[model samples]
Target: MMSTRLEPIQIGAPTGRLSDWVIAPMHFNGFAGLPTTRNESVKSPKFSCFGHQWRLLIYPGGDRESSDGCVALGLQNTTKESIEVETKFIIKHPHGGGDIRKGWDKVARLSPKGSAVVGDVGSARGYNNFALRSTLLDYLFDGALIVEVHMRTNKPGQQSAPFVPENPAFQNMLKDFGNEETADVKFEVGGTVESAKGRRKRAKTPTNTFYAHHYALRWNAPTLADMCKPGEVSPTTITNVRPEIFKHLLYYCYGGKIVEGDLQSDAKDIIEAADRFGIVSLKLEAEACYVDTVEVTLDNIVEIVTYADSKNLALLKEHCMDFLSSANKIEAAEKVSFDDIPSHLMKDLMVAFARREGEGSGNGDTLSSMRVSQLRKLAHEKGLSVDGSREMLIDAIKDDEEGGETES
Candidate 1:
């Protein structure tokens, strides 16, 4: 028989209400095959505990002649430094009453030179005869076993300082800086100028000018910093952007608050300008304002969802999907011209819709309710083929909906 010694499994840091810290659960699979000799031992991968690397060593058979029939377990400090910790080891009961053995706690001083052998440290009792080899098998769940370790510092708790809110005086000081008139850069933006008289185009483009300090622009907009070279002194012309949208972008750069009113009509333009100029915070704020203030209705859901996908705005996409997945709204969602929407977005929307339908609401089964011809039409609209049987077509539709490549 192969030695039942378990391979170490690495796990991520644990999460929960930690008195101090918890270790991710370690699982030992195929427990029945664990080595039954004194020479072999199962060890856990090194995990972070009390700011030091540590591993759990388990001798399924026994670690020595004295530990004949019982399993032996110990904690080893794997680093060069000494660590002091209060630790507990738990072996969950397989049939589900409680731990296989009552857990024991120990205040241990472990070092690179030696391990804190359970039940052996001064007055500290380890689970030496935790279980006999024959009886230990009963604690295995589905031929697997799990162990968890909890650790905390040996130090006394200290009092924490109280929290303080920001000062209003500091806010006033910042507002004064924003209103300063010593601007060093000028931006000339949007108005059509005559290009050629015969073509009925204006020869000179009409534009509005805004002023800002170069330092602020460079600090916030990297693209603007690249375009406005150091020591150069000429007004930079930014064409092809609406004057109002550019105004809002510059306002944000100047620390002016962007109210919902400013974004209601030009949210999309503001987001595009922010993205193009690499103003990440502004882009995020604009996306938030758009989602929070703008209404999602049949008329604009498609446009908004498409824009959200292009910008990778997860919150807006989720909102749009939730709106579209409502039972009363499915018909309106289907009316959307999904042709221009991204394939991935379409797939997500379809999957979400299918799940909602599958929940067995009064809306009859989604697949059975729709005619074969309608299903084919829907597939064809989504750039999928209609050349298969009804079941095959449904499967293909589901495959596409779930982001799988359509089988040829």
Candidate 2:
């Protein structure tokens, strides 16, 4: 039996305005007896289109008793609210690579299945003529049938709204309670009002004291909340964190945006501080900023991966793994010291490398045992230099596998 590789297709997000339509491809395998007199349908994976989840329902045999011989397909709006959608269904021709039917386009009001009956094909008599079971079998690629559905919202003028309301009332509330006049708690960073940059100035640095309402700190940062008492007169001395980074964290707590540029150079420190203070949202934001701005290279991949592992940042670790496995594979293998990588992480990298080369087991015979022709074939497949002695070829292959450039 041949192994069927499931490759995910990349779908680009809509550019300017919200997407008017979404295109999703559904592949159905194990197509035996389908669509009998009973109402039966195969469902596609749920996808987000126009701010709502949707799926495709394909019926090989007619869905209803009236239309038993023909194929039936429908669009289902899985979301709770009623949605207006226009759908176009196209089936690939079994023989030639074109549309079997010209194309079927319909506009309807769609709601959850039980609530309202909408956006269905062949509801009247069922589409019996075009997609027969025998014809679909011929079109199957490796015993799988593929169908494409194009779905667009009927309300083209409506714009997608943000899930959270950006209200000014919360900012007003912060200002009222967070100012020095009303704030009962104080945070002093490094015994100075200014940050590291301010310390370099000729002028004397004053004590860095930020006033905040204890309630705000309690609500935003659970860890910090634990340290604070109801009416403590003495300021909380934070010796570990820099004044500027703490200011950024405070800003986020007060419903202010943390500009990406301000934290670009201090992402690691900020993320660590956020993690320590139990600021989940700020930690996530810092992680995203770090991933977006940091350059991934052979020299830094191991360090970054280790840092991510230490911080328990799953997304950053996954990003680093992806880069090391694909973009900087050869360089990482050659330059990164395996001693620095955790044992479990190294094992994961080995497994990934084997999977990329379609190797069942990572261990294998040396290049010397293989013939010159075989070595040449392997080099050609891997895009490596083939003009070399058996020993030289062996060294080159090993270096390439280890993500190192062959020596001149």
Candidate 3:
């Protein structure tokens, strides 16, 4: 079992959009209120193209020492290995003005971030001074700044993967996921603390116990490998992870068999667990599963969007928001509770809705085609009626805005 390693994944054929460049456009509304202090950045939701997840990181007030007084922009590679991409950035002008286009873009290579937490920008690469803040602010018409990224992924260079002869005994070990007889390591996941011997103590529950081989975990997960190192005790206790999630993690660690469980309910948890275990490949796999499996409906849109935003699951959030902003669904979405949306996620939604308005029905200056909830929220803020049809609500908000302008 120790010598059983699989062959390199045969890249026989390209997946979706593998042969073409992907044009991703991002719009940030209410840019003035975003943090202006240096390196304080915001990220666009994850997007998938050419079989990889990606994002655009924006440091509104620059990133590093040399980047001060400018906005920094970077393209992040979310695959298991490092990637090089041919990339370009275009700052779009509002109200039919010419776009501020530049070919001068320096993108550093993006590598796999093993066990690095979020906000660690090591997995991304782009210009430190993507745009001068002083001048860049002028492009934010309607408090919105838009960027269009033209990128095509370069084919990964051929690399050698170790091919070891398979052992039947080792292959059989993988079949027994939690078999104590076969597994050399034990783990206790998710238990409560109790007052024992006049002090609080951590104890393991029997149902929560899981078993696995040390070498398999050590080889598959760098974080778990650290635990199996010298000076570490057995029956390792992990309070943060549930037993089911741990079992799933062990399943992937032993072999590469990801159980096609209920992904819609557990996908977020799986993605999170994989990240915690330094399983970059598993994280990517779980993310792809969630992105592909989850269906966002009006009833579930708010909850799904909030989760995606909180996790920075960009592509999932983007897809849900797209479904949410469709003309037929806008009013239906208002019936759901968005009050629970985090401030940051609410901002994302607002920005998305504003963009939809700009592209669909807005005059490029005045607000139009806002969702019913948005209109009611505005009406309430301005001490007006929150009742009526969408059109009536829009009219009331419009009339109030006109009245305020006349008074001013």
Candidate 4:
């Protein structure tokens, strides 16, 4: 019998043909003996963290956050291994022609695989709608290697502008996303990744080969102690990620192979890094942190937008809005100065209100300050039965006064 192996296809390069047909075949081979490890006897709770373990907070695109708080990871969705895991599609366009409601409804109906409805940016009022989950990005882009989506814009004909690669302001808007690239000035997808000590280096390989073998690869670990050497981890790579996060990322460098009994947080940071870099497998791992453990908090709300670019938390952002509104009603709310909060969260709040209030009429008609104040007065008359309403009304009044316009 003759052997047949297809030639390697390089993605993101201009010359190669985009893969038309790729498939994974199941095998019926007999099983081999399982090998045991020295640390196999010891086990810890899954996702547990302790001394020396590191995890990263990552953005969907796999970049670090600008605030120096969260780590970043880039993910690829096609390689996910779990049969039971849920996936979603997120779309973001800066210029803005797509109707948020219509677009989301279309995705739900049109998706080849029925996906559960996750939250979206347009779900809230003040959101840019251009911001979305990176997991959704892979799906919406649909393996195009490079995608250019049309946006809605105020400018006539500009309503359909492209979300170009050149439009990387969003990527650079955060420190972590911008920090991941090597400064060599050439952007090559899947190029070699070399650590200073020569302990870790990643090479370009085929997706087919990667998935076919069920094999996972990680770069070798290098420490700051070893980084000073001439061939050790590059200074550029070292500079992008935090030392602690990188220290944890070292585990992945060793082939996604963690010590059997290690805590989950140890991998959290690393998984975050992977998500920033578009390493799909890592994002899936990091998402485990929130499963059965999700909560609503203003801090976490800010963190989701600030660190992960995940707008899937529509409810959380709503809570933040309500909290801010309530606080403002009781006493003037501090002007929201952060670009991330005022720009994004406000949008979320508005959309949330509209969704609850009904769009364009009914409850929606009450989105204005006068309506909020009316609701507050009613709540006050009724002993503040509405959660956070009075404070929200107060904030509206304060804003009106500050703007030299009274809310009638």
Each model's lDDT comes to: 0.65, 0.66, 0.67, 0.32
**Clash number for model 3?**
3
**Candidate 1 residue lDDT tens string, 1-408:** 777877454232123312555655767788779887884788888888666787777778877643678887666777777655667777777667657544435445555544454544432224556667777677787888776766665432221236687667535533544233656667778754322122433325467776666666786787876667544567788865677777777767756677878776677778878877867668767776878887888777888887677676655775687677773656775777667667666645665576566643235547533544476688778887554334556787777877754443
Clashing residue pairs for model 3: 45-314, 46-314, 46-315
Kindly report which residue stretches of model 2 are placed more than 4 angstroms away from their true locations once superposed.
1-167, 192-205, 327-331, 347-408
The stretch of ten residues in a row with the least summed lDDT in candidate 1 is 9-18
Writing each residue's lDDT as its tens digit, candidate 4 over 25-97 gives: 1111111111122111111112211111111112322222222221122112221111111112223332353
lDDT of 4 at 186: 14
Off by over 4 Å in 3: 1-185, 190-205, 213-215, 227-233, 262-265, 327-333, 336-339, 343-408
Winning candidate number (TM-score): 2
Please give the ranking of all candidate structures by lDDT, highest first, separated by commas. Answer: 3, 2, 1, 4
List clash counts for every candidate, in order: 16, 5, 3, 56
TM-score of each: 0.40, 0.44, 0.36, 0.23
* CA deviation > 4 Å runs, candidate 1: 1-181, 193-206, 328-334, 350-408
Best by lDDT: 3
Q: By TM-score, how accurate is candidate 1?
A: 0.40
